[model samples]
Target: MEIAIILISALICMSVVAIKLSDTKLSFPFAMKKQLFTAAERQFLMLIERAVGNEFRVLCRVRLIDLLSLKTDTNKKLANSALLKAGNKHIDFVLCDKNDLTPVMAIDLVYGAGKDGHNVQRDFFVNGALDTASIPHVRIKAKNGYTLAEIRECIETKLIPLRRRQGKIPFVAANDRPEVIKRSTKPTRPLSTSRKAVA
Candidate 1:
């Protein structure tokens, strides 16, 4: 009995050590951080999101990509959907961002000269909604301002109209209350200066 008890305690000690070592080395889901896009790309994205009136909560980070093709095109969507259907391997980036906590902005980025039909279609969908929807749609084409300044200009323009719609003052909506009109219709204040999260 004494020998059996000693062996059991030894086994328990070994098991605890094994678990501790595995915990440190194991590649757990959600262990990796998303890669940051290039400065120019991030600048472009921030501009687009701001133009569309998303305040860009932390959830926005996951959706940021090397390019927006991940969600914008139907083929990719179908492929992803099929993956779910098949119970095949999961895509980490897509899964991480799929919770849809924030609105998804699918910007189809075409880096070079040859035109991509996928990109063209995405742009059409994004821009076409501008005329019909109150929510700002995704912008298409390389606009007059590809520069950071240009991006800022677009966001500011969108904010201007939203402010106008709100009238003089903005009011907070509360439980079972009437839509409170805001007393101040001031536009959103611009950042004092742009800061890059990653260089």
Candidate 2:
């Protein structure tokens, strides 16, 4: 009888331990919701959608962490610094190439009384980072309505120069002397000179 009691006690102990272990496991208390944007943001997104129309893909509220990265050697210090600067922030809209999803430009929407001093400083920092990385960005003030033409013009103004710079290639003349070609592996003219030529 004592042996049977001991076995029963061991079984009860094991059951208790199992219950405690199950309680310790992680539990998710949250549920997924559909609406992700505020009312004002939705209105702005509609404007962006209308502006972009069928030409380019517009992504809303893109995380800065997803966009910016340190492409050089994985120096933890530098990587951490870049992440710290960009981790919490997000761009209002990102225009991308429809085919390959290459980011064409980043747009920030400034609303309500224009950016204050702190916002100005933040903008300067973000602008500096984008410029250093050779990415084009534009800041647009939130207004009642936006015209497609205006948006197109703004994008084209920045994109045209970038496209020109990216498309430029060295030109070699068929009639150029063999000696000149032999002396120079590439064209002597700079890319900026080619830009002028293309223009």
TM-score of each: 0.31, 0.64
Give me candidate 2's TM-score against the actual structure.
0.64
Off by over 4 Å in 2: 1-25, 31-34, 113-121, 163-199
Clashing pairs in 1: 168-183, 168-184, 168-185, 169-182, 169-183, 169-184, 170-182, 171-182
Compared with the true structure, all predictions reach lDDT values of 0.45, 0.75
- For model 1, how does the per-residue alpha-carbon lDDT over 73-146 read when each residue is reduced to its tens digit? 45977756544543421111111122354332323444444343324333343343323333343333443357
Clashing pairs for model 2 are none
Give the per-residue lDDT digits (tens) of candidate 2, residues 1-199: 9999999999999999999888878666788878887565688777777777777799987877787777777699977887898877778889887888877788888766654321433466678778877779888766776677887777777787666666753345676647643476666765465344454
The candidate that wins on TM-score is: 2
Q: Model 2, clash count? A: 0
Candidate 1 ranges beyond 4 A from true positions: 1-39, 46-118, 121-133, 140-147, 168-199
